[model samples]
Each structure stands twice: as C-alpha cells, then as structure tokens.
Target: MEMQPATDSRLELWHELMQFYIREAWLLDERRFREWLDLFTDDVFYFMPRRLNIHRSEPERELSPVGDLAIFEDDKTYLTMRVERLETGMAWGEDPPSRTRHLVGNLVAEPQPGGEVKAKTAFILYRSHHETEENVFAGYRDDVLRPTAGEWKIARRTIVLDSNVILAKNLSVFF
Candidate 1:
C-alpha cells in the first residue's frame, strides 16, 4: 500500500520522538551512561543479534535465532552492571576511553496500541581510541517507547547492525 502523508499532530509527535533520540545520542556520546540508562524503563530489553553473511535463499539464517549468541542481550539490571563496571576505572578495555560520535537520522514513528510508540531510526556510530583505533558501526534500531510521568522511556530496543563481522576489539561503547 502507498504511504500517506503525516497529519499535523503526527508530524509534531514525530519531531518530538526524533528529538528524544537525538538527546539519547548526546548522552551516550558524553559518556553519561547513567543518564542514558534512565531513558529506558525498568523492564527494558536491549538486544543486538549477530548477522549471518548467508545467501538470500537462506532467509531463516539471516539473524541469530532466539537461543543463539548475540552481541548484547541485556535487561535493565545487566545494563546497570555494565555502567557500574565502566565507572570503576577498572575496565581495561576502556582505560584510554573511546571518543564517540553518534549520528541518528531517518526516524519513523507510529503509535502502537497500549499507549506505546514504535519507532525506527538509522544510526552511524564512530568510535576512536588510543592512537589509531577507529571503528564505524552502521545500523537501524527498532524501539518501543512508552510514556511515563510525562517522559518517554524505552520499553524495548533492537539494534540491527549491518555488518556480519565486527572489527572492534570490544563493544565497550553504548550505541
């Protein structure tokens, strides 16, 4: 079916959602992991499954299945642990700290039932550390956002990275 133009209210909601995502990116880029974690609901599920470089005919094997290994499959508690680990100054992987820039764009949001909004956004994350380490991760995210206390919170998020093989030594940076 052909897509119809957004209504005025829809446009306004879209703009607000886009701004929310931009704010999220800023928080991560600023290394404010606690603040960024606050954006998610207590029951949030953040997942990033590994992709398979398979032929188009093997549709069932494209993304890692439910029981397969994923780069990130964290609940709120696990996410908190990650943030805490980074704060201890003992995470050797982040000893030098990675400077990152998160570029978020091409957002499309639609209201879902039960007072939630499902939004998809494209992102390009650039991370540089040490003297010459640099890695670029490009992907789009599917997020389910719920409003609580007049603010939006991520109830679920699935990050679909484009590449099959990640070159980064460790995914220490939050996307």
Candidate 2:
C-alpha cells in the first residue's frame, strides 16, 4: 500500500518530528540518559531484534523479535533501570563512557490514526572507547510517535541493525 503525501499542516508536523529525532541523537551522544528517557512515553516498547542472513530462497528465515535472541527488548521500566545503572557509574561497560556520534537521516513520516505518526529513518553510530578501534553501527529504525500535550513522544521503536553479527564487545549504548 502507498502512503498519501503529507498535507501542508502535516509537513510542519513532519519537520517537528525530524527535529525531535535530531535532538534524540544529540542527547544519546551527550550521554544525557535522563533527558533521553523523558522522550519516551510511559508505555514505550523499545526493542532490537536479531537479524539473520538467510538464503534468498528462504526469506522467511530472517529477522525475529520473538523466537530469536534479541540484544534488547525493553519496556519503559527496563529502560529506566538501565538509565539508573548508568547514573550510578557502576555499569562497567559505560564507566569510562565511550565517545559517540549519532548520525540520523532519511526520515519519512506518515500521519497515522489517533494523532500519531509512524516514522522510519536510517542511523549510523560511531563509537570510540578508551584504547580501542572505533566501532561503527549502521541501522534503520521504525517508530511510532504519539503527540501528547502538544509534544511528541516515542511510543514504540524497533531497531533493525545492518549487521547479522555485531563485532562490538557490548551493545550498551542506545541506538
């Protein structure tokens, strides 16, 4: 099915959504975990499902968020706990705090029912930890955003990474 072109008013909304994503990336890169957590709704569903390389003929044996293992399948509470852990400065994976840059682009947003927006975008993350080669991760994200009290909030996000096997020692950073 094809999506209808956004109306003039909707175009303004799209711009706001794009800005929201840019701010989100900035927050993550700055390690502003508390503020980043605020961007999500109370019932947010954030997940990164495992991607598998299957033969072209066996397309059905591909990505799985349920049957296969996932790097993260966190709800708002789980995400809050992660933020708390990071704040404690005890999460070894982030104690030293890796330098990261998040580049987000190719955004497409469509207005959905219930005053929500469905958006898709591509992201490239560059991370450099203390004495290690830079780790690069590229992926696409699908998100459902809800407008609450005149502000946009993420209701759900599904990250689909480009790599079938991640080379990073730990996937601690938010995508």
Candidate 3:
C-alpha cells in the first residue's frame, strides 16, 4: 500500500515521536525497565511475533499471524510481571544475566487517519552473554503510535524479525 503524505504539522509531530522512540531505546539498552514502562500508556500493547520458515510459495499470513506466534503480547499488567520476575531473580534467563545492545534506525513515520501515526523502523539487536558470547536479532518494528496526555504512547507494536531461525536459548530481552 502507498503511504499517505504527511502534512507539515503531522511531520513535526512525527519527528518528535521518533525522538521519543530513540529515548525509549536508550532506556531499554541501559536496562531501565521502570523508565521504559513510563513511556507506555495504561493500555499499551507491546509484542514480538516469532519469525518462522515456510516454503517460498507460502503466503506470510498462513505462516505467521500476529496473534498466533507471538513471543510476547503484553499489556501493563503482564509487563509488570516480567519486570518483577527479572528483579526478584526468578527469571532464570536473567540469572546468568545476558547483556544486550539495541541499534535502531531507518525510521519511517507516516500519518494515518484518526490522529494516529504509523511508523516502521529497522533494528539490529546485539545480545551478548558470559556464557554464549554473542548473537544478533535484526528486524523491523511496525508501530501504531498515538499522542495521549502530552506524550506519545505505543498503541500497538509488531516486530518482524529478519531471520527465520532463532539461535538464542530464549528471548529475554525486549527488542
């Protein structure tokens, strides 16, 4: 589908929104979960769908639907649980403690109907550990952002991973 041209006002708003996302990325890379949570709205939907391998002729929808293969589909409550688990040492994945760095760029923000903006950004996530050394997960995040209470909050996020196969023991990092 063709993108709708952004108006001058909308373009300005989109620029601010992109900066907001960059800050959020910084917080996450710094392991600032509480601060990261602050950026989300009460009804935010943060999610990552599992990328899978299928025949080249197969339609993407038949292979991986947004609702079906999600590594995460979280609201504020669930996000809180995840954070709590990480904090209390119950999350085994973090027991060994993997360090991660997320590099996000190639942001494209376009205005949508109903005071919403649709944005897509390319990301290359580098994750390292004392045990396994290093691995990378590269993808594009498709987001639906809306301005609320003087801040931009993600209403929805869909992560499309570049690789069909995953090598990490588990996805503990928020990409």
Candidate 4:
C-alpha cells in the first residue's frame, strides 16, 4: 500500500488557505473587529447550531439542524451589526473587552465548483476577561471560501462546538 503525494495545485491551495486562517486568527486576537469583518464576503453565513445530549440510538438528534434552534445563525448583515455594537462604548458584556487567542489547525480543503474551496479546521478559542473570568471553546469550522478579487473570502462558516452546554457567562467574543 503506497500513498501518493499531493499535487502542486493542492499544495498551493493548502498554503493559501492556511495563511488566510492565520491572518484571520491574528485579527480576532488583536480585537480588530472591523478588519476581521473584511475577510468575510458580503453574503457570508455564520452559524453555530445547538447541541443536546441524546440517546446512543439517536445519534442524528444530538445536534440541531440549520434554521432550527442555533447558538448563532448570523448572516453578514447581522454580523456587521454585532461588530458595530461592539465598536460603540455601550455593549455591556464587552465593556472591558476580553483578551482572546484563537488557534486554528488540522485544515482539510477540497475544491468546489465556481472557484470555491470548502475547508474544515479544528479550532480552540480562549477568552479572558477582567480578573476572574475565563472561557475556552473548542470546535471545528466548516467553511466555504470563495475567491474574490485575488483573495479568499469566507462565504460560509459553520462552527460545531464540542460542548453541549456553554459555561461562559457571555459569548461576546467571536469564534
């Protein structure tokens, strides 16, 4: 049994996507919300479905489906509004502005039709707030990246968090 090496195109695509994720993470960690928003397309769909404890016999019932009860299901417009709210000085939960570190790894990308790439990566998002508050979230992101003006923009992102219940007081920080 032999394993074949990846083609040049595939390798290049991987490198490009990896760099994209790195820069996105950097932007988020720096709390550069507006800059981070630029990485997403105008019609981007950002979603995180809700999860529940289910019986072993009903595996598919563990996670809620899209358009159902979701932890987050923000379109680009909603995302922009959220960013705007954060930019203002009145967002209560983010008054102090939490420090965050977003780590993305284990990228797996496949080319889609019409110059798009569907990629998935495992991520760990750590957030620390004033004195005693801290939160850590681990998840996998299924993203559809579209090529736009010589760069890649996230057209869709579906975050599947590992935890069924959120322990954090507030989910103000972006994932």
Q: Which ten residues in a row have the lowest lDDT in candidate 2?
A: 1-10
Residue-level lDDT tens digits of model 1 in 69-150: 9889999999999999988999989877899999999888878789899899999999999999899999999899999999
How close to the true structure is residue 158 of candidate 1, measured as C-alpha lDDT? 92
Show how many residue pairs clash in every candidate, following the order shown: 0, 0, 0, 0
TM-scores of the candidates in the order shown: 0.95, 0.93, 0.85, 0.94
Error of 4 at 171 (Å): 0.7
Q: Residues 1-175, candidate 3, lDDT per residue (tens digit)?
A: 3545778876787578768878988888888888887776788888877676766687564336656857778888988887778888777777667787888877778777887888888898898887767889888888888888877887888787877667777778886
| Cα shift from native, residue 152, model 2 (Å) | 0.8
Model 2: residue 140 alpha-carbon error in angstroms: 0.5
Which candidate do you rate higher for lDDT, 2 or 3?
2
- Candidate number with the higher TM-score (1 or 3): 1
**TM-score computed on alpha carbons, candidate 3:** 0.85
Q: Write the per-residue lDDT of candidate 2 for residues 1-175, one digit (tens) a residue.
A: 2555778886787688889999999999989989999999999999898889988997766778564677788999999998999888788988898899999998888888788888999999999987876799999999999998888899999999999989898887888
Best by TM-score: 1
Every candidate's lDDT: 0.91, 0.88, 0.78, 0.90
**Which window of 10 residues has the lowest lDDT sum in candidate 3?**
58-67
Q: Pick the lDDT winner.
A: 1
Candidate 4: the clashing residue pairs are: none
